[model samples]
Target chain A: MTAVPDAIDQALGIAPGSPLHALRALRPEFVSGAEACRAAVLDPEETLDLSPELRRAIARRVVAGAGHDRLTEGYPRPADPALAALADGEMPEDFALAALARHADLIAETPAKAGPEHLSALQEAGFSVPQIIALSELLAFACYQIRVVHGLGLLKETRA
Target chain B: MTDTIPQVTLKPLTWTPHLPPVEIEDATPRQLEAMKVTPSAKKVSPYVRTLAHDPDSYVARTVLFNAIMYAEGGLNRADRELGALGASLINGCKYCANVHARQHARLTGTATTSALYAGRRDALNPRDAAIMDFAEALTATPPTAEQSHVEALRAQGMEDAEIQDLIHSIAIFGWANRLMHPLGHSD
Candidate 1:
């Protein structure tokens, strides 16, 4: 009888296939579901009020920073130079105040900082309420991806 | 100039969400598929629809979410909801905390969640306390969640499946809290 491997096995490459390829073995439904979340966040057709480049930049920042310490690739590459810089954790001169604040919030560098004052500051920077919400989701979704990828990466590291 | 210290509330306080939901207009077939997995009763929530920009991913997330949350024969709903509420608090999503807390309260008919929301840990039963401690720890950045958390759960008489369910419950909130916190605001 074949012992069924856990998500950690397939996701971390402790099994026969690469992490990306091995993930199908754990539970196809979960792998597919997680991929779908990636497509929506990093590669979407909807012209987000926030551009795809900017969205990817946030994802880049999150993946690089999340604790997994693996998951170094698979993030969308931004074409815009400013976005590229942001993705690399640089604040360019033209960076939007709203974006900088949110990058701070999602990066989780200082948890207590993301309170009413920060929200008000973004509002004062001229973001409409809905846009602020969208930005929040974008950054948050980035963090979500970091966790998923990192979790899978961890499973790979300990595959005995 | 004298510095004024910010006042921290010591009493258990209630949490509520007050964001206006983003409403779906066309109800695209793909969007409809996504809505089925959510708890929404009518048109899909704006948040779900917004994510439907990539309908494939939306379907995938919804499917996974439903399995983790509504699947039969795992940890009971209220306990799972408590895990969610605990994670939401750590993530600072008042809206998610309110929604899941209300769900837990409604299912168990208990209103003691105020203390849980306010960061109080003294009065909880061993089970709820164990679950919340693990949830909050796991939810923290860099994840201070440790093997001791698991040991504490075992000591509380959680079987393997229940412990696995609890981990999934807390882990899913790690994903869910980040997604929902930015989608809307709550009181």
Candidate 2:
């Protein structure tokens, strides 16, 4: 059997040749592109002034907040105690990390509720424009991954 | 330019970025490639340019988005567009909502779009209602989509592949809305 080559499949435990796996195969680009996107957002070539550890921690926080405990496993807490605390949803004492956590939660929970003031807050906390964009991408990816996982879980349960 | 999320509309809308967009002239070769700005290409949208600040993510996102929304042979474009509209509406990303609403209208008709904008799912046909219902549920935070949602789509005659298509189309907007809504506002 072909190994489950996609992250979504691995996350969901989709066996090769399973019906859901076949369904995913119908659109190979989405599977591959999603992997690429995962890499770009989670472990990008450029950190955009946001450290890789902070990004992973933020992703864990957002995914955990989305209530995907299983998905949270994919993003282990960072070694640094502060980063680990951030991943656990504790508000960091650092103003910048705290600000980033709040922004991540807002975007993950209620994207529509976000506004210009949110970006301004990031700026005030010392995030540059590129850093803000990179942060947004990470938050966006977490939100997207949660939905995909949830949607696929439904498919597996009902259609399996 | 409006800083607030607008009500869903069919009218053409513009996106205003909260952060400064990458200056196209000063763009690195990677950023330019990610934006797909060839010599003959028309002007890129501010959204694209702004996103290009992180070229790797931008390129990967674009590739995934195009495959989910524009690829052939699973769900039809009109249905995928409706799925996009449903997620956008729920997320209150007026910019994404407006774009997909227009696409949904063009490929199908304005009836479904009108119904969705008016918050009247009952007015939609059973198939569209099922699709929209699933879209909203899946797009919700912590996602309320259940087995019933899959069953509903199956009952509407959507194959597993088509339902998969619908899922991706709706889910991508969750990503899109977060980026678009928070990073910028629509006018």
User: In lDDT terms, which candidate is top?
Assistant: 2
What DockQ, between 0 and 1, does each candidate earn?
Answer: 0.19, 0.71
Whole-model Cα lDDT of every candidate shown, in order: 0.58, 0.86
User: In model 1, where do residues sit more than 4 Å from their true spots?
Assistant: A1-13, A16-28, A47-54, A76-81, A97-101, A104-138, A146-160, B1-58, B108-120, B159-164
Quality of candidate 2's docking, in CAPRI categories?
medium
Q: Ten-residue segment with the worst summed lDDT in candidate 1 chain B?
A: B1-10
Q: Can you write out model 2's per-residue Cα lDDT over B1-187, one digit (the tens) per residue?
A: 1222223447899899988899889999999988888989849889999999999899899889999999978899999999998999999999899999999888887777877777666678889999988999999888999888888889989888888889999999999988888888788
Candidate 1, residues A1-160: lDDT per residue as tens digits? Answer: 1355433333343545554344334345544555555565555555346676776676667656654433434455577777777777766666373356454554354442355566566666666654555555456555554444443343332221
Cα lDDT tens digits for candidate 1, B3-110: 323322222333322344335555566556656644456744556655554454455556767766876775789988998888788887666777788788778755
For each candidate, give the TM-score of chain B.
Answer: 0.78, 0.92
lDDT of 2 by residue, A5-61 (tens): 666786777777677777777777888888999999988898776778888899899
Docking class of 1: incorrect
RMSD of each: 7.7, 4.6
